[model samples]
Target: MNSEHTKTALVLGALSGLRTLSATAVLSHYLRYNSNLKIKNRRLKFLNSAGFALLSKLLATGEIAIDKSPNIPDRVRPGGLSGRTLSGALVGAAIYSINKRRIWKGALIGATSALAATFLSFYTRKQITRNTRIPDQVIGTVEDVIAVGGSVAVLEGDR
Candidate 1:
């Protein structure tokens, strides 16, 4: 795949590591609004649908809200990490499919980046919260902003 596509996958994947549904939500929103871009894969056609866009947005919003709660599990946990990895893989594959490139390569890069970012972000957040004396909720909100803003920036950069 080209450098542009690779960059897209990596950025979106890292965003997924921060917030599992954020990348997919942004991607679905992009696909829904950008009628000029079409998904060549039939299976991924749902990503461009209004229903999927709405559902993804709702889920992402809920995830952001719940992320602040102390009851929520750490993202480094197996289930959370796997979910992030899958989200990255899906977003990466969708991007590659849209560009008519190799989906497997995109998936691999996305998954790997997401896995690494999960650990990196988790530890960094932990350290910041411990050393800076900032509330985790606040730090989490900042992370949410990074994920959402970063996703938007990456997709917009492509256009």
Candidate 2:
């Protein structure tokens, strides 16, 4: 693999780890309190891993697209939603974890990041596919996955 693909894979792996952990936390909370999903801890863990893998694949694809495509958005641009989502997730999670006592507070920050990420994915998708009229399949797939993940994160609420 090229350096760009390597970097993409690394970032996706990291994001996958993060997503799995966060999903575990979210699912654990639900099972502990709600008792509705009938989901076992083991199942939750599995789901977390699966969700993370899906996210990682999409993100990895997007990263590769960035290197291969001419129309990739610049990170510094005002409307660079993909960058905002990626950076926001990292910063939001970090800030939240700093004071782990108030999980709700941290969750709120995460929710905000997720919301922003959703918008970013949508914007990036539209922009990336604009000129070509026919989006690269990989790019399109990443955008879709990001959009779905972002929405799910938001719906899960301040977890």
Candidate 3:
């Protein structure tokens, strides 16, 4: 696989670690607008649909709002981690498929990156919150920006 494809998978996966739906939302939006793409997988065709794009964006926005709540479970929790991993895998596979490369490789890289980033980001956020005494909501907002901005950068850079 090309290094650029691998890099995109890794970055999107890491962003998924921060917000499970963010990468998929951005990717769906990208796919929706870029009509020249020729994705062969029928299952992935939904990524190009306006309805799917809208739904993913709404879900991502909801995730962002709920993420700021103290009652929300840690992202490293089994359920959260699994969702993020799946999100990473989906987007990674989509990226590779769009590039006419092997989707499995991208899925593997994306899932692994998401798994690693989940723990790393969790601890890093905890440390920053503990050390700086800043509200977690503020940190989470910053993380949202990173996830959203990073997703956009990775996908747009590929063009």
Ranking by TM-score: 1, 3, 2
Instruction: List runs of model 3 lying over 4 Å from the truth.
Output: none
> Can you list the residue pairs that collide in candidate 3?
none
State the weakest 10-residue window (summed lDDT) of model 2.
1-10
Instruction: Note the Cα lDDT for every prediction shown.
Output: 0.92, 0.40, 0.90
Off by over 4 Å in 1: none
Please write out the lDDT profile of model 2 over residues 1-159, one tens digit for every residue.
133322222232233222323332333233344423332223224323445446544664455445346576543355444444443343233323322323234334444544444455446656778866665566755553543354345324433
Give a tens-digit lDDT track for model 1, residues 1-159.
Answer: 489989999999999999999999999999989975667788788999999999999999999999999999999999999999999998988888889987888888889889999999999999999999899999999999999999999999987
TM-score against native, each model = 0.97, 0.32, 0.96
Error of 2 at 96 (Å): 5.2
lDDT of 1: 0.92
